[model samples]
Target: MRRRKKKHEDEHMDESWLIPYADLLTLLLALFIVLYAASSVDAQKFKELSQAFNEVFTGGTGIMENPSPGETQPPSDGEVKSSGAEKEEKKEKADLDKEEIERQAFLKDQEELKEIQKKVNEYIKTNNLEVQFVTKLTDEGLLLTIRDNVLFDSGSAVVHSADLNVAKELSELLVMNPPRNIIISGHTDDVPIRNAEFDSNWELSVMRAVNFMKIILENQELNPQWFSAKGFGEFEPVGDNGTAEGRGLNRRVEVLILPRVTD
Candidate 1:
């Protein structure tokens, strides 16, 4: 009976063989689980898990672990460079836009000035006056010229009767289109003058400028806030006083209109 039982036990199982087979099955299951986990991992999550495993096995703290609340993710080298380049491109585009706007505004101002010049020229042409009028565009704005003989008597500060109509017409034009600032400057030849009412050419020139201002201000539509008068006398001469033609050219009054930046 004992010999028969031993033979049945041997046939049923071997203890050493069972141990090795169970170990092999456990190794295969573990290997399959590792492979599955690896397949499911993304680059960002895999990096985090790899750092955790390294810390556990080596008994050392990982630099990538335990980030502060305010700490940002490490940027890739390519991403960092691309962001900087994008910022520079945006700044350049903004600067270009600003320059274009400024250029357009400058062109618009020039067009308005040209229109004003045309209107003033037409008015002078319609009047059959003997005085020579000149118009020019300058940095200060438009300048209009009128000979002294057209407005004033010889060696006198008084405005002539025939020139009254001229003054009234000019005043109307100024009222219609107001400039930023208006300056009336009186100029005289080198000839000296002395009288009971005036001491020298300077005083006579100043009186002439004042009288011209009075005529312009007489118009109720004109604003006196931006108007001024000055006398240069014999100091500022457009031509030499040695000749008759040059003397006539020096004896003149100039009206300057300044542009308004706000407009």
Candidate 2:
């Protein structure tokens, strides 16, 4: 009995058993605390704690709050795309407007040319003088062709009585609707000439052009400053000089009316 009592006192003095019991109680207390936290979770407090931890780890500001509920801001990417599209549309519209204005201006110029052509055609038809004169619209201007036989004698640069009436009628029309500039060009056949009065076809053609210009300038309605005369001799022939008809075509005087814009 004495030996048993001594052994029981030694066992009671050992602290190993108390340590295991304290550990079990501590684990049970931790489990209860976890269950209590799970049962009564605070969403706002959790979010704040999570944000604070993220800010500390990332070294940045906390998450921002939405300014208004159900009102989202437009994305920067989408805004930039829309702005570029609008600018492109405006640029295209400006280009279209410029093209339209240029087209209208071109049409207006064409109409003015047509009007001038029609008026000259009407004057030619009304006078019943198509046999002695030829009129046509060229790129340069309106051309009036008068036969050399009608205006001058062979190898001479004299203006005849019959030619004066023809010149006067044409001058009257030109004065009525004056152009920016008028050029009287004299031409002759390839037939060579050697005479006491004139040296060659060049002199004869130049004299004939001058004589015709003098008659046209007699009318005060015509502007002398806008008129000029030139002689081509047989250099700028309209047809081949091999045939009689071609020679007739070549031997003619032309009146060229130039546009104001060209001047």
What's the CA RMSD for each of the models?
Answer: 8.8, 15.1
Note the Cα lDDT for every prediction shown. 0.78, 0.75
Pairs of colliding residues, candidate 1: none
Q: Estimate each model's TM-score.
A: 0.64, 0.58
Whole-structure CA lDDT of model 1: 0.78
- List pairs with backbone clashes in candidate 2: none
lDDT of 2 by residue, 5-42 (tens): 34555454566898899989976875675445334445
- In candidate 2, position 107 carries an lDDT of 60
Q: Give the C-alpha miss distance for residue 27 in model 1, angstroms.
A: 26
TM-score of 1: 0.64
**Residue 87 of model 2, lDDT score:** 99
- Model 2 ranges off by over 4 Å: 1-110, 176-178
Worst-scoring 10-residue span by lDDT in model 1: 63-72
Clashes of 1: 0
